[model samples]
Target: MLAAAPTNALPRWKGFNVLDFFNPDPKHRRQHTTQEHFRWMADWGFDFVRVPMAYPYYVRFDRSRPIMPHEVYQIDEQQVQHVVDLVEHANRCGLHVCLNLHRAPGFCINAGFEEPYNLWKDPEAMEAFVFHWAYWSKLFRAKTRDQISFDLLNEPCLREDMNDQFSQRSAVPKERYRSLIVKGCETIRASDPGHLVIADGNNIGNEVIDNILDLDVGQSCRGYAPGLVSHYKAPWVFEHPEHLPEVTWPSVENGQVHDKAWLREQFAPWIALVEQGGGVHCGECGAWKETPHHVALAWMDDMFSVLTEHDIGFSLWEFDGTFGILNSERKDVAYEDWYGQKLDRKMLDLLTKFV
Candidate 1:
C-alpha cells in the first residue's frame, strides 16, 4: 500500500470561498453572502470560509483610473464594517474565516483595471500591501487564532507582460515572494502575534514556497491542477477551450495525463513540506460548472482523498458561482429547488462526504 500523506500543523478544515467582493470594481460585485449561507455550511459539516476580497472594495480609490499611492489608505468605514460584520456572522456560525486580498495594491491575477504599481518589484505597492494587512490585523485583533486567519494574497505570481484574462502566469521570483511574505508576517505579528497567516503557493498556487520554511505561517495550494479537469472550458482561463480533447479521469485527456497517481504527484511537494514541519492546506479547489458533473465528482473524490489521507483540508473555489454548489449554472446538473435558488445536491452531497 502507498504511504499515507504526512500530517501537518494546520487543521483539516474543509470549506469554500465566498466571492462577495472578489472584484474591486463595484460593477462585478455579487450579492453579499448571507448569514444563512454560513449556517448552511456549518449545518452541512464544513468548518471554514475564505472571503476573497479586492482591496479596493473597502478602500476609497479613484475607480475610473489607476489608483494613486497617496490614495491607498483612504479607508471607507461602511465598507470595512460590512466585511467585519461578515466575519462576525461566520464566526458566530462556528466557522473559521481566512480573509484574502485577491486584488491588492499593485497586483492581481486577473486583468482589466490599470494598476499604477507592481507588487513584486515596486516599493510603493509593497507598502500599500502591508498597510492593508496591518490595518486588517489591528481591526480584527480581538479574535483568536482559531476564529480568524489572514490569507496574505491570492495566487501570487508575475504576469507583467501578459494582458487580458488569457495571459500565461509565471511564478513571482521566489526571493521577491519570500521578502514580501516575511515582511507581511512581521507586520501582522507585531499587532497580533498569534493570528494565523497563510501564503499561497508560488506559480498561482501550483508550487510550494520552499524558501520560507522558517516562517510559522501556513501555505495554501490550489486544486485545479491539470486545468483540463478543473477549468475545462473556463473562458477566463482558455482562449479556445472548445477545441480541447475529451476529459476523463484516471485516463489521458485535455492535453495532459489524468489519474489519481498524477494528482498525487502534483501535490507531492506540498506533502513533503508537511514532512519538513510546514502546515499545508488547499485554500481553493473544484472544477468549473461546465465540466461533466460525474467527471467533476470523480476527480474531486480522488483529489479529496489525496488531501484527506495527508490530513489536509480544502475550500471549494466558491459557494455560489461557476465553481460552486448554488446556482452554479451547470448544464448537466438536475439542481434542487433551494429557497428559490437552484442547488446542486449531488455536488453538495459529494462535499459533505469528505467533511
Candidate 2:
C-alpha cells in the first residue's frame, strides 16, 4: 500500500558488519579491514558493509574522565575526514556503507564503560547523542544515499526513565522510547534529508516498536532469536554454557518452537512498518562460531529464506573472526585460502545460494 518502502535504495543482497575492523584504537582498526577485504566481498556477490564505530574514536575527548552533565563534545576534524575517506574507499571498491554508532556518549550495550548519566534520562547525554548525528549530517550532507547512509544508534536498550538495560517483562513504554529516537532523527533530518537514516529496534534490535512510523526513517532488526540455536555455548551471551541444555533448529524451546512460523511471527512487527512505507533491514544476524556449522546453516536457511521472501535487506553479523563467513574460527568449518585469508567454501557456497 505504501509503495513497498521505496525498494530499499541500498542493496538488498547479503552484507557483513565490520565491527572489530573499525576499533577505537587507530592502529588496530586500520589493520583489520583491508583493501583485500573489500575486494573479497565484491567478488563473492556481496556489496554492502555496515561499519559499527565507537564515537570516542572520532572525537577529541578524554576517555578516562567522566562525561560532565553539560559537557560540550568536540569532533576531531581529521577523524571525521577519515570516515568520509573510508566511505569513499568503500564506494570505490563497489560497496555501499552504512555508518553506525556502536557506542555513543551515554549508552552502549557492552558493560565496560560507565556513563556519568543515563542517555535515555539525561538531557545532556541525549544532547550529545543528537550532536554526534548532527555533526556527521553536516559533514556528509552531500553524499548520495547509494554511497552511504547513517545508522543513528546501535541497539537502543536503555529503559525509558533509567539508563539501564531493557527487560522484556519490565521496560519503558514503546512511545516513550520512540520520542527519544524522534529527537535524534529530527536533528539529523533537519540538516541532511537526503541520506537514508536507520534506527535499530530496542532489545538489541530484536523487538521492533511502532514508534518509528512517523520518523521517515528506515528500521533495522536483529536475527539472533532462539539464542540456544544461534548462540549456544557463546560465553558473551551465556554465563554457563555447560549448564544449558542442548539446542536444535526448529526445536521447541520453552514451548516456543524455533521454526519458520515462529520466525515469521517475530518479523511481523517490522514487516508492518515496511508496509507502512518505512524501510526495514535485518541490521545484524549471524550465529556464533561455537554453534555447529550444519545447525547454523539450517537455522540461517530458514531465517534468511523468510527475510528474502519478504524482500528485506540484511547484513550478516560480521565479515571475519568468530561469526564471519570468511575464515571464521569455527571448529567445524573447513577453511581454504581465498584472497590470502582462510576462506570457508562451504559457508560461501551456502551464502551465495541465497544471493
Q: Give per-model TM-scores.
A: 0.96, 0.88
User: What is the per-residue lDDT of model 2 for residues 162-265, given as tens digits with 9 covering 90 to 100?
Assistant: 33333232334687678767877788777867767888887678776666666677778889887887788987677778898876787987676679889898
In candidate 2, where is summed lDDT lowest over 10 consecutive residues?
161-170
Error of 2 at 195 (Å): 2.0
Against the unseen true structure, what C-alpha lDDT does each candidate score? 0.88, 0.75
Tell me, by TM-score, which candidate is best. Answer: 1
Q: What is the lDDT of candidate 2?
A: 0.75
Residue 2, candidate 1: Cα error in Å is: 15
TM-score between model 2 and native: 0.88
Instruction: Return the lDDT, model 2, position 102.
Output: 86
